[model samples]
Target: MPRGKYTNHKGRNRRFTNPEELEEQRRKDEQERRWRQQRGDESSESEEEEDEADKKKASGSKTRGDDDSGSGSEDSSESENSDEEKAKGVSNLIKIENPNRVQKKVKKLSTLNEDLVSQKPQLSRREREEIEKQRAQAHYQKLHAEGKTEQARADLARLAIIKQQREEAAKKRDLEKKQKEEALKAKTAQTQKALGKKT
Candidate 1:
């Protein structure tokens, strides 16, 4: 009634022309907007609640208050200090007054020396054979006294061979023993370095 052409489309023109329809559409749009806004607010509030819970968990874990009385960090360090002090105390106790320990240490040291000596190389195979030959010769002499000349002659021959072998074997064993002594000397030197020659 007022002007030339309604620039809007036919449906839009119809809506604009009817006041009740326009009001109803506006009310629907406002309701949807409010629903969306409410959902956003609820999501943000939930996130804030989660953040607060996480902060509480982090603080609680750092303090370890549930497992220990509120001073967990302090107590652990104190315990470590106490353990070190106890170790020092034990060392001092051992150093200050323990004759029995000293005696035991000396006994152990002597035993170690004996072990080192015993580990030195022993008589050689030839030497052992020579000793066996000597025993056999003695047996053969006894047999000769009992009237066994053939066996005694054989034993005497073996005895001469054994004597020759014994000299060679003795020399070999002496050389091995000397080498063992040298090895022990080197080992002792290393041990002294490690122990710093404590009296």
Candidate 2:
């Protein structure tokens, strides 16, 4: 099936068969726009303040009560109400007139031109590599300072071996000292025994 002009979802078409139907549709759209404008509903504006509207109603009633108490006619109060409606319509318009104004965004978009040639000297790849190397070295140094690095573990193992060797040397010195003391005592006893026999 051939695709329709209006909607090509499944070769479907939507259109008015009569010119009068189109006119009627246009009229309905215009009426909707006029109604929204009078109702103070706008695309750019948020919902009108309920408290402000209540205040206006309260003030209007107060004026009406005063007019009722006085001899003022009802026409004056109707005009005042119309003026308030006009003020509301004027407030619904966008106040800022800038065309370059930024709209709110969830994701950021870059503004830099990628194709533009530059005269200024750009940083070489080696510069960036050096920066990365320096960062890694600094990070490792911090870990070493905290004694949480692999180097710290290796040093601890080396220190344990040195301590064991020192302890063994100290035990050997103690044994040698004991043997020298025993030999000196034996020699002194032998000399004493010989002198006593001679006496």
Candidate 3:
């Protein structure tokens, strides 16, 4: 029944009893109060001051309106004169160009010199084909020397058999799909004819 204690039906106190724990709790509460103030939750004092200033300004404006009714035209004319004077002052002002502004010099880039660029040796079509043929012959000679020609041939045969089997399976699936579609179309035609006869 103490200030910060609670008891259930079992009658056990659910509050910290140690002095250190109470001190820690007080410190935590103080820290939270400071945080709330920083977050603008405790700014009622400043807000009250602002409200008072706003009320004063509103009352002053109402009193000024009652007194200024007779002088409204004069006030408007004075304002116009002030605006014209400001415009005249602006028009009489001289604009001085900055003496320290730098003038940029345009530079012309030099054209590329054909002689300075290194050129790759150009091969004619016949020469390119001959080079390719030589490379192929070299590669074949290397494979033959390594006794891999038979193994490569066997691999190619196996790949061909796999490709042929895949093609045959695809063809069989396509034929079966075509037959099913045709049967569906025939059934639809038969149903339409029977409906027409009944009508």
Candidate 4:
């Protein structure tokens, strides 16, 4: 092995941690995790709900007080709208700021993302080859059905050769049968003529 500062050399063996120290570290990690989880629960939607209730109670009190001031009620309502808008902005920021919110997926708004979305997924070599073979087979089948493919032409040629061979064999059989019948008839006629001459 290539020796380096981090690599264990012949003179120095790898260091081992004590089991007690390992146990302590594990305990610390568990405690820290639980503490973080408790904080996350406290800072979650429950806090938002409480804030909303508080806002509503404050608005109800303001509306009651504004009734005596007449036009102040309308202005207060508008101010409340602005306040809610600002709160909405803060709410978005708060949601983003939450430590426990794990951003597993990043939204990429670009031409590359659109192109990637439109493109087919990556496939294994065998899968790609299988898909290609299927496509080729389907294309050939379609062309064969239309009698427009080379394979269809070759099949027709083979069938024609077979048909021609069959026709030739049939013709040869007919010729042989006709020849045999003619020979038999000639022999019988000659025999009859000889018998007549003798009688």
**Residue ranges of candidate 2 with Cα displaced over 4 Å:** 1-122, 195-199
Estimate, for each residue in 1-199, the C-alpha lDDT of model 4 and write its tens digit.
7666585557676688874674475456445544655677545434543543464454332222222221355567756654564443345222233559787766667976898989989999999999999999999899998889998999899999999999999999999999999999888889989888542
TM-scores for all candidates: the values are 0.22, 0.32, 0.25, 0.34
Which RMSD values do the candidates have, in order? 38.5, 16.4, 35.0, 20.6
**lDDT score of model 3?**
0.60
Query: Global lDDT of each model?
Result: 0.61, 0.58, 0.60, 0.63
> Which 10-residue window of candidate 2 scores lowest in summed lDDT?
62-71
The sequence of per-residue lDDT tens digits that candidate 3 reaches over residues 134-183 is 99999997996675898777877898999999999999999999999999
Residue-level lDDT tens digits of model 1 in 56-168: 45433221121221135756874564455454324522224334664434458788889989896788999999999999989877889775798667877899999999999
Task: Put down candidate 2 lDDT per residue, 71-155, tens digits, no spaces.
Answer: 1454477456545644343342213345699887554333234323334556799998998999999999999888899998898
Better of 3 and 4 by TM-score: 4
In model 1, the worst 10-residue window by lDDT is: 61-70
Of candidate 3, the 10-residue stretch with the lowest lDDT total is 61-70
Give candidate 1 regions above 4 Å deviation.
Answer: 1-150, 194-199
For model 1 the local lDDT of residue 157 reads 83
Candidate 4 ranges beyond 4 A from true positions = 1-102, 105-125, 192-199
How far residue 169's Cα lies from its native spot in candidate 1, in Å, is 2.9
